[model samples]
Target: MGNIVSCCSLDENKKYLNDDEILETFSNSEINEFKKRLKNNIQIVVLLQDGTKLPCNLQANFQEKTLCISCHQKVKNKND
Candidate 1:
């Protein structure tokens, strides 16, 4: 049998990410580029470690100080 792969670390206590935590994952230039793409309505895909490309629309949750992705369900279904 093949070993199962997990996309994210299992952390039962974790719920949501804060601003700093989210920003830390990307460089300043990358963040700027993402914002520009978001404004232009350009399509973007997140490349996963498992070699899956998940189509996403980036959005900010200011109240929560977090970033979110509105994924394309069709793409996800096809990939799965």
Candidate 2:
């Protein structure tokens, strides 16, 4: 497992894009649709440098445009 980093911190992650810094051709309606879908939940596949595809479930804060990574753990049954 890798170390967990805070996405909210600008100092921690310099890759964060400011509102003006981001260049998007999407219309307001399209952007709103994306935000709406994100609120429900979205599955994103990240392709690593080594060619590994990692699937992640995420939710977003519309105001901040920030993401919250979701993780689910499976519990083992003692009777099994």
- On the 0 to 100 scale, the lDDT of residue 80 in model 2 is 38
lDDT of 1 by residue, 5-66 (tens): 97568778967889988889899899888776655555569887668888877776546776
Q: Which digits, one per residue and each the tens of the lDDT, describe model 2 over residues 1-80? A: 77878656446655776776564657789989988889988987666566666677789987887889764542333463
Per-candidate Cα RMSD to the true structure, in Å, reads 10.0, 11.7
Which pairs of residues have clashing backbones in candidate 2? none
lDDT of 1 at 4: 69
Lowest-sum lDDT 10-residue window in model 2:
71-80
Model 1 regions lying over 4 Å from their true place: 1-42, 74-80
